[model samples]
Structures are given as structure tokens and as C-alpha cells.
Target: MPFKNDERELTSAIQAIQRDPTLRLYAVAKTYSVDHRKLARRLHGMQPRRDIIANSRKLSNLEESVLVQHILNLAAKGFPPRMSIVEDMANRLLATRDALRVGLRWALNFRAKCEDPEVIRSWFELVQNTIAKYGINNADIYNFDETGFMMGVISTAIVVTSLDGRAKAKTVSQTPNNPIKAMSQSTFIKTRIPRHQNSSPTSIYAAVNQFTKGASQIMHQLALLKAENQNLRQANEVLSKRRRAKKTRLRQGGSLSQQDAQDLQDERDVVQQVEQEIRASGGRKPREETRARRCGKCGGTKHNARTCQIEIDTSEEEGSE
Candidate 1:
């Protein structure tokens, strides 16, 4: 009986012969358990039987490798190729190769043969490793799901048009918050025809336009000025009350004398003046001049008695005398 052997066994036998040119063919054949004549034929560059070969694909090995790589690339971009897309791509590839177009059955069979669990696992691991290597976090990654709209139910024709000669007509209502409801052309024409026949042409064209940008700006300024005027009136009332209280306290012989009251009024006036100046200038008051501190002992502005050079020299002179 002839020895039956697979491609791997035959390939190993050929490699053994290549590695050691002096390697005995019979020994190589014995090691692989294949026929010596078959091994010799393989070594001479003879192709193996179709059943013994690993690849039985319609596409060449190189072409299939390319297809697998393209699929992986699409998967990495979060757009994994679907069966229909794969079929289209395969058909295109086949057309370039002058091969017959493939059907859905072929696509199903191709997927069944190539979609190995191991390959999927490796692809997932590769994506994870790449993300980790580049220090990518969950926040940096994004997923985009596709959405589609159905056009069958939507009307393609224009549903509304202005009855007037104007290309567009402005509608205004006393209630600004209410949304305008859309109406079809037929409903609008039917409803407006009676009103239009009775109404004058001037009335038909007399739609109120929206307030302009300049008008809105003027209204805002007016509101701000009203608030400021109210604030100023309140401040004047408070100042008047304070003045009245001071006069009453003076008449009652309070602890404060008239001169003291006058001084207090002067201080309040100065503060009010500073506030007016600040408001007019639209800025904070200027920093005050810092007063030089007087000495506790001699009332000298330069130095205190503890560190006074003049006092120290005078004491030394008195000791010498």
C-alpha cells in the first residue's frame, strides 16, 4: 500500500534535506513516515496533492491574506465589515482578478471558514495592547453609532407658500412664547381665502416685524438707568435721615458737643465727596498718604526713644559729667 502523508510531513522532510545536504532521503522519509519516493518528488519541487495542501480557497493565499488584513483594519476603525460589504468587496476583488462574481452562499462559506475564534481573540488583544502602549484612556476613545432616516413617509414637495406676492411673510402675535404651528398649503389657502376676500390689501401686508437690534439695545439701557435712579434716591433718603438724627442728638445735650457734631458731619461730607469722585471716574479712590508715626517719648516722627541716637548720646554725656 502507498504511504499517505499530509503537507506538513512532506514539508518537514524537504526542510530536513535542505538543512543537511548529506541527509539520507530514506531516513528523512522514515522520520516523517511518508514514502521515500514521495519525499524525493517533493524535494525536486513537485507540488503536493490537492487534499494534502493546506489551502483550498478560491482566492490565492496572498489574496486571502490581503482580504483578512483589510477586514482587521476596518474592525480597528470601529466599522467592522458586514457580510454584504464583504461580499461587495470580494466581488470587486474577483472582478479585478478576472474571476466569476460570488453569491451569498459563497460569502457565508467564506465567513464560516475564515472567522476563527482564535483570530478574533488575537485581534481584540492587539487593539488592547495598542491602546495601552499609546497610553490611551477610555475618555480619549470615542464610539460613533450610525443612524438612518426613512424618506418614504416624508413629503418631498413644498407644503407651504405665501398667499401674498412676497416670497416670505412674517407672522406676529401678542403671545411671544407660543410656538407657531405648521400648516399645509391646502389648509392655509382654504382658511385664508375667505379672510383675504373680505380684508383690504393694506391689511394683508400689515404684519408686525420683530424688534430691531438697536431697539433691543435701547430698551436694555433704559432698564439699567431706571435701576440706578432708584438706587440714588434711596441713598439720598439715608443721608437725610442721618443729618436729622445728628441735629436731634445735639438738641438733647448728648455726650457729643456741637463742635464734635460738626466734625462728624464734615467727615461724612468728605466720605460722600470721595464716593462721588470714585463713581464719576469709574475707578477706586486713590491710595491715602500713610501718616508718619510719632515717638511715644519725645513725639519725634523719625525714631522712638528706645532706638533714639540723640537720647543715647545725651545719656552718655550726663554719665561722663
Candidate 2:
């Protein structure tokens, strides 16, 4: 409904609802003593109260400081604070405007030091503005980006209410809290290609699009391609492992002929040869391992990460001590 009211003529909207053949049944069951025509019209335009979107953290001109202090004050009193502790101070009564100022100021001061952090830069905003100004579709324009994907199931929120209706709690999973992974995959950009190369059939792959700036740009491009190639390689390894595991399972009750292993090795050699030729054509640097991981079995290196045999929860063990 509009903020202001003009009740001159019960709108056409009211007339429509009243005249609608279907609403007659519902309207008959529920009605006020008021005139039927007016009541029907009012229901047509009635709108529910809108809700505001709540965010964990926001830019600190002032209120940010206050919220931080509120959280901190709650923490000091041995109560769990509702607001995030990051870039915030502990202060009670932050919800009230008057009491939150001082704590907010302290938080603002601390935040100033970390103001230039990469996460705060808002890359999406920068990209938008740059595209608007430079026109992203220009012939010479090239898009560049870096990305990472999840290796584990990331945890999210769920509210658990007690049967008694007196207590509630939330929990987190062992996975890391990564904003990029969540936003990119869960939101509109459902699929991602780390980086891509433009290739044509007759000219051969990477035989297209040479940079004007010579070696420097070419080196950077090659490095990006290498990284993308490495990501593809890891995916290939994972796929191959899955295939091998599936084959192993299928052959569990059966015996493998010597020819089967030889055939597999032959296929692998063909793939290796093709990859070598592709790399030779591109003439780029090799891809490097992007992940840092510890061995699961006896803390030893070089093994399958998923099958890590160590069953200890180190974080829990430390807390217990």
C-alpha cells in the first residue's frame, strides 16, 4: 500500500477482488460487519511489512563501532555475543544509540590499520566500474582471474531448538569458511573455468593470440595457463583414481589378466604423449602444486589425502589437555 491514503473511490483493485469469481468463497467465510464492497477492496491492496536484510559486518562510519562494542561487552560478561568479533569492540547496550559510540570509535581506530586488506577491496565493485569505464567488450581486452574450489564439504548454519523451547545452539563443521567458494558456486556463477586458451583447429592450440609486449606478458600468460593446466591435471588424476577404484571394486571377485594392466599402461602412454605434444606447442612453464596438506597416516607424506589413516582430532585433543 502507498504511504499516503486517498479513499475517494475504492480503487478498481478493490472492485476486481470483489468481482473475482474464485475469491467469493473465501470472502464469504471471513467478513467484517462493514459493507461487503469496501472490505473486499481493502484486502486487495493490503501489503505485509517488508523485512530488512541482515549482514554480519559492514563499513564502519559509526554504527559498526557500536555493534563491535556491544559484542565485546557481552563477551566480557561470559555471555555469547551475537555480533562478529572481527573489527569490533565489546560493549553492552550497543543496540541503543547513546552507549555504543566510544567502543565504536575504538573499533574504528583498530580497523583503520587493516583497512587496506585484500578482502575489503570489493573486487566485484572494481570490476563493474572498470568495465563501465573501459568497455569490457573491446577487441584487445583480455579477462584474467584466479580461483580455488573446495576439497571438502563446507559447513553452514542451522538452528537447533530444544524440545523444552528454552535453549538453542549452532555448530560449525571442520571445513574452512571461504567466502569466494560459497558466493561463486552457491550464487549465479554456477560453473567456473580457472583460465582459458583460445584455439582454432587448423592453426593448432595456443597458436593464436600472441601479446604485443613480447616476453613479459607472454610469461605471465604462460604462468596463468600453467596454473589452469595444473588444475585440469589434478582433476584428471582424481578422475583416473575414481576409475581405478571402480575397476578394482568390479574385479574384486574376479582375477585381472596380465593383458589388462598392459592395455591400461598403453592407454596412459598415449595420453602422456598427447599432453607432451600440447605442452611443446604452447612452450610454457610447468604447473606447480597449489595445495598445502599434511599426511593423515602417521604424518607421513605422499599418499591419498582422503584415505589418511590418522583418526585423531588434533584440535579436540589440544583442548582436552
Candidate 3:
């Protein structure tokens, strides 16, 4: 029979047998609900089939992780990739290593890993945290309903509405060329109209809505202003502390600290270098220092053989010749 329990249960069963000498394999297997034979095989140092399959997979662990992350990122951005896209991505990654392409339905097996309970839970947590972080309101969130029509059959229809009536505007279907053709279905596009101002309920609701909106806006603005003020105060405190420290250091006959002085000097040097580069007329780079010329005869720097001050020993050269 196929292994009934997962690798973890089987491993636990094997460990249980090993830990207690008196424990029988069947008893431990029964406790973990794993096949006794599989447990025995694992105890004998035989690796699980799952591990073997994982080792034989086309993508390595790290590559698979990267692919999963990429898929998740696309999903978070409201553009979930299709199974074919996943297959193509896997093939691209494999191609980088000059490996053979994955087989058909490889994406199905890959999707199984991403569909784990833990992974799904994490996805929900991520969305929840994001919503909470942004303080999103339920009223501000909207649901989208998508509809499609036959491309050639759809014709532009005029939408008419009365200014005072409560009737909704709708699309009108055009007559088809063939008399036998059935008339296409009409589509309704609802347009919101203001209720009668004389209605007490409507007027009360409008007033309440206006007041709530204004209050919410005021609260939001206050929150923003409070945060900005806090930041500015923090910045001011930092600047004041720095100024005091600088004065104290100056009174002690010291300028900036060693590291600070070095950083300032480096900043000045970078600014000077940038200024020089910017002021340069052409696209030419800064001129490099010229290498000093050496005299071949006298072996002296800054002068070549033609400009050497030392006189040559012509007598020895003539005798040798």
C-alpha cells in the first residue's frame, strides 16, 4: 500500500523506536498512523520518495523560491500570472543554466507547493496588514464587476434619461440585418440622481453624510499636521544638540571629531572634483601626471640622453671600438 502518513510522521515513528529499546516498530507506527513497513525502511537509512523526487526536480530549492516570490509579487500587484506564464518563467530560469525545458503540466506541480495552507494564510495576513497599515475604510473600498459582449454584434446605443424622473438609463439594441436574427439583449447603466429635497428622510441623511465627511476630513488633516510638527520638532532638537556640541568642542580647542573631520574633508574633495569636471570645456578627462624622463647615458631623471648635463666618456668607447 502507498504511504498513508507524511514524511514527518514516518520520521517521528522511526525516532520513537530508536529512543526506547523496548518499543516495537508496529506500535510506534500505529501511534503516528504511518505504514509500519515504510517506517522500518526509513530506520534502515532508506530516504523517503518525496526527498528523491525533490532532488530530481528541474528547479533547485533557491530557484523555486525565487519563482514563487516572483509569482506572489505579480499577484500582489493585481496581475496574477497564468499557468503558462509560470511555465515560461521556469523555462527561462532553466535556460540560463543550459538545462532542458520542463515538461507539460510542470506548472501544476509547482502550483501545489504554493497552495500549501501556510502559504494561503500568509497571503491573507499580508493583505490584512496592508489594509490596517493604510487605515483603509470600508466605504472607500470598491468591488469591480466585469462583463463582456460579442465584438462584432455590439453596436453603439444612445442612453436617454429624464432630468426629474427616477428612471435609469439603458442601452438600446439595434436591429440586425437579417430578419431572422434575434434582437440582442439590452444593458442597463444605472445613473445616481439626487432625491427630492422636500423629503425629510433624504434631507436628514444628506446633512448627516455632509457632517460626517467634514469631520473625517478634519481628523485626517489634524493627523497629518501633528505628524509633520512632530518630525520638525525632532529635527530642531537634533540641530540644537549638534550646535551645542560644536560650541563645546570649539571652546576645548578642537574642531570636529576625527571621523567627522575626515568625512568633511572627503565631502570637500568630492565637491571640488565635481566642480572641476563641470567647469571643464570639453568632454576630455583630467590630465594625468606626466612620467619623468630618464637620461639613458647618465641614468638621471628629468632629462633624456640628448639633454644630459654629464659629459660622455668617449676615450673608453673609442678604445673598445
Candidate 4:
């Protein structure tokens, strides 16, 4: 319905929203899109600062990583990347196009590195502008992008044929993963976590995704990995079954068949042969001897302290006389 009057229309919508007891303030985005700032301006411009609600819960280590991601995303989207707190929300509450550009600029360039105080303040203005343009208080307004960082470029080369002047047959320069970038914090891109799977896919065709878009590149690589994983899984399953079977046999006092016994003997022989081969390759063989008490005087292993040969020899001449 064409708004009967701008003020009347806004007031009606606002009233309806207020009247809906079950409707939540943060639960909707369209509600914040009405440019209430303009409406208030016409109505005496009595801009009042109202407290906005921000939700938070205790975060574990993993949850903290998620929250860091969350903050980074908000920072990317031109939102005030404030800690979980309630405060007066302005620019984002009344979003505008110009403001959104500023926010994006800030995310991409300003926040990427440390800057002079004045530069940071100006960049903050950019962020505010982005928030004003977008008017997205809730988290749904932002988009995510995953950028791959590959390391090696000079290691290989490919030819590119061109049809136009200065663009014809040529080689391209490549940047490694650790390539240098400007030091300023503002000149950064809105980077999101490289997700293993889509957090929110737009369609039923799950396999037909951006990740699977390049059939020759991504799909082929993933296909090889998938095949390898399946092979390993199959091998693991076989090994597990064998181990369980062995345990069952041991529990039941199972006896080996003639062929199985022969196989065990063959395995034993192979191990023994290996050991013998190693020994023959100049290794010392260990001796097996009975343990016996030795006499301290004679350094012998068999005789005890009494009646030792050394003790008898000491009285040999006296005995002869």
C-alpha cells in the first residue's frame, strides 16, 4: 500500500510492530529500514538517544574463536565492532548508501593496520557511514567470502594466448602466500573463515556449489582425496575386523588348522632367519651360563668363600713340611 502519508505510514507500521507482543525488536530487519531518522527530523528533529540491546553468553575457547570470527565479520560489514554491550546505535540503525561505502572502505583499508589518530577517526567516520547506509542492526546484513592463499608461483609457468594488442601470448606474475601488503590496517579485505561446508546454502542442490564450481580444479582435487579416504577407510575396516576376530579366537581357546599352523611356523621361521642373518653379519651372540658364587680371593665363579683354591695354596708349603 502506498503510504497514505510518510509520517502516517511510518507511525502505523511502528504501531503495528509495537502492538505485536510476540514480535521481537532484533528479530526483524525490514523494521529498521524505514529511515526513522528522516521521519524524526521532520517531526522537530528531536533526536533522542535510546539504549539498544546486545546479547552475550559465556564463551568457551572454541566459542571465543567463533566470537572473534563474529566480530571480524561485523567489522567487515561496517558495523560498530563493539564488544558485547548495550549502547546507542545510530549509523547502523539508520543506514544509507554513502555510509555503507564508508564502512566497506574502513573494513577493507582502515582497520587493516595501525594508523595516525586523525586517520583512524576519519576511518571510524567511514565505518559509521557504512552502518548508516546498510541500517542492519542484526547480523544478517553481511556477506562472507573465503579467499585462498597459495604459496608457490615462480615454481611453474603456463602460457596465455591473447587476441588483442599487449594482451596476446603472455606469462603472468604470481604472488606467494607470504607476499607483502601495506602496513595500514584500513587497507584490508573482509576475510571470513574458510568454511569446510556452507553455513547457509541458498539452494537444495548442495553439491552444485561455488566450491564445486570449477569441476576440473576443485572437484578433481577433492575427488582424488575422497578416493584416497575411501581406500584408507576400507583398509581400516579390514584391519579392525581381523583384530576382533583374533580377540574372539583367543577368548574361545581356538586352535589353528594345519594350514594356519604352517603359516604361523613360517612366520616364526622368517623372524628367526632374519635374526640369524643379522647375527651372522658380525653381531655378538649372547652366552647362557649358570650363576654361581665366586671366591673374593681367586676371582672364580664356581667355588664358595670356604675351601677356595687360593686359600688352600696359601698353606701349601706348610702342609708339605
Cα RMSD to the true fold for all candidates: 32.6, 32.1, 29.3, 26.7
In model 1, the clashing pairs are: none
Using lDDT as the yardstick, the better of models 1 and 4 is 1
User: Which stretches of candidate 3 lie above 4 Å from their native place?
Assistant: 1-198, 207-211, 236-256, 281-321
Best candidate, lDDT: 3
**True lDDT of residue 65, candidate 1:** 40
Tens digit per residue, CA lDDT, model 3, 1-321:
345668778767777777896998878877888888778788889986756755448976546645665565556555556666667777766766688999896875564233579877886787578669987665444330111122232213211112222322255423222223222111111111244446546544554454444444334334434544676799999988876776677689886888766755786799988876775656655643334556899877877887665555675677789
A best-first ranking of the candidates according to their lDDT comes to 3, 1, 2, 4
TM-scores, each model vs. reference: 0.26, 0.16, 0.27, 0.21
In terms of TM-score, how similar is model 1 to the real structure?
Answer: 0.26
Tens digit of per-residue lDDT, candidate 2, span 1-321: 122232323343355556875666334423322344444545765432322223433332333433333334444555532223322223322322334334343432332223455744785567668778866564323322211112232212211112233322236421212445334333322222223346334322222211112222333334434544676799999989956864785478655567766666787889987886687679754333334455765665576556665544765677899
Tens digits of per-residue lDDT for model 1, 1-321: 456568788888888889899989988888788999888777787776773545435565435544554555556555555566556656655665488777655654563133679987886787688778977665444431111122232323211111221222135422122124212323444455567765664532322112222233333334434544676799999998977777787789776777767778898889988787786588644334245677887788878878867778888999999
Give the total clashing residue pairs for model 2.
Answer: 10
What TM-score should be assigned to candidate 2?
0.16
